[model samples]
Target: MNEVAVVKNQILDVEISDLINNGMGLVKINGYPIFVKNALPEEKVQIKITEVKKTYALAEVLVIYQTNPYRVTPKCKIYDQCGGCNLQHLSYKYQLMMKTNFVKEALVRIGKLDVKVNDCIGMQDCWKYRNKTQVPFGVRNNKVIAGFYKENTHEIINMDTCEIQDALADEIVNYMKFLAQKYSIPIYNETEHKGNLRHIIIRKAHVTKEYMVTLVTKEDKLKNENKIIDDLVNKFPQIKSIVQNINPQKTNTILGDKQKVLYGDEYIIDYIGDVKFAISSKSFYQVNPIQTKVLYDQVLKYAELTGNETVIDAYCGIGTIGLYLAQKAKAIYGVEIVSDAIKDAKLNAKLNNFNNAHYEVGKAEDIIKKWQKENIKADLIIVDPPRKGCDSSLLDTIKTMKIPHMIYVSCDPATLARDLNILSDTFNIIEVQPVDMFPHTSHVETVVLMSRK
Candidate 1:
């Protein structure tokens, strides 16, 4: 086999059962349930081991011994390599079912939370629904390549078409490709690091039906970009803003310190229900707008906010959730560590005229500790920490504050469960709901509601 190393483990054939984290079908392998990244339950498959860990070893599906009746071929040509979308091969219904069960499993097994989890809020259109995408630019085979990095590696998989992104995004990539060919703008090389092009951040306004392109890099090769943008605007007609984020950092971070507008407005406004949000390339926003609306609606329902109650939104990135929940509460306090995000939150609140929503830029734990010193009370607190979950100190501070109601929005169930377990000591989890914010990917966005015991 082309000198590829092979290790044989005589794993017993077990019924394809249960999806563990990362879209793997968990089955007993030598009395231990292991995750197989590309497999679903009910499919008989052979796994090739890659790494052995203490609890679970990572493996890839080598062959499908027998395909499940539910198995459907993935529609995307680059589905396997793109890494953005998992479960792209699975049916939409199956995606919803697994995502719903994922939340239930986390709550019941880890948190010991005897809570009723509602069915996952699924999307109407599973394909090409993402509103925003960040495509990296790399050079390979003497050609500039703009696409997502391979699943876990820095190597860019040269691509012009991606099914998960809005079909227009692919078209825009193609347009950029043509523009590069005509203008001879060199593609950024990761190894050589000498190209003007670095990344492309594309966002489409749902309300205005307008698109904005944020070209991210240190140098701009598209001289007279205003004319180019005007040409693009004339052609596309729907494009509102074309901007360049001049970032030279050799990291994966999006947006640069300096931003220059090439055409039209500086920022495109996005609307979620009655509130309008101004989004920039630097601002953090949920990629899936439709599902995020559903997720926020679920949050609103669970929060049961009254105009007289005070609420605190922890880790409030750009204050979207707090802004969404602001009108219903008397006073909404948003705490964010990122100064830029806090600035965005305040701007968003002011833009939407949510006079009651106030934001402060500081770490959550520090804010909670200080607020506790002043005897600040919140009827509700929303915590949406990163995937690693909240730190123990933050959790301890949260406990110390003794907020009456807590809403935890998590992207990782394992961490969510771990945090919930600690929180369960003083709070009783009342509701658990999973929202498929990222369709196709193994990732899940879940919200847990807790009330003080």
Candidate 2:
């Protein structure tokens, strides 16, 4: 519990020994860990301490004396400042290797369970893979600016394009920015919380080429709504839907309860492996469509359905996973807390003629408990929880229910490892597959299959 002997503004030369979870490199001085931004492992770099905490300190890389062979020049112009893509400086091949190692390390160090983690499945064309883009609107120097925020701050980093986002999204955002400026649409002010426009969220279907534009605003109305819609429809012929979301609050949260359809339908159709989905303005569809199919296919494989088992999908947002597995299972029961997503899920199930798939609006744990009390049994359970991993109550229910098979799709390796350790007592870890859903970033999606012992 002793404080590290590090002070602010101190300069020291250190060799990066490892990369941490947040994509920062780690170096130890007197056995005290110091995190250096934009530093690579096995590279010796000169770092300047910015802040010193009780146990660890944060530093910025000043100069790289020795560069790792995997290091590459970042393609982004504001790579040093923008926090959107963290591992762009590292080679794509090494980025996959590092992400695989990150999962393995989390399992071994945190879960204390040594398991074989497969090599990360990367996309052939990693760049321009994102199907969605949500850019905030802000004003800097009396001019409208729209882009991702800077690292660890709300300050917008003005940019023309993003490497990962779909090209159409970039075009739509830029065009919206131009129209906003020309029409004198006021940008939202986070400080005073008084403005008109807040964010521009664009979602594109990779296979369909259909586009949905959602203009997030402070109030329910836009200044020149009709003219703006006319201009947008005239320019973007591929735009299938245009909507306005009103967030009349003083908080930083995007999207509000009220929404109005400006033009076209309220939803845009998208597909993943022949499974159609209706994506609304606030739908929780995957950003990477290609890799999403890969991830879902892996889950289906791990489920090992033999066409007679009943499967339960927890946190089944929009019922994508359950609907994907519906053909293989006898019956699929999906549960989600969000009512909007549940509504979409039910609609999607009917759209696809999936009569066996049923969706309900409720917490996964509470619904599962109710099902268990009603003598409904799940042969297999699919959990695609958020970064915090499965809730303890859900874990307990799964353990008590003794589901034969469990497929866990995790976005955070640390939490997945922790949850896996807790469940290891009853289930045997069969295999772990890491998928590079978000390339050029430290975040990885892992699919783990566990069978009851």
Clashes of each: 2, 0
Local distance difference test, candidate 2: 0.92
- Candidate of highest TM-score: 2
In candidate 2, what are the lDDT values of residues 238-305, reduced to their tens digit?
99999999999988789889999999999999888888899999989989999999999999888888
Q: Give Cα distance to truth, residue 238, candidate 1, Å.
A: 2.0
TM-score of each: 0.91, 0.98
lDDT of 1 by residue, 64-105 (tens): 888776678988788778777778778888888888888778
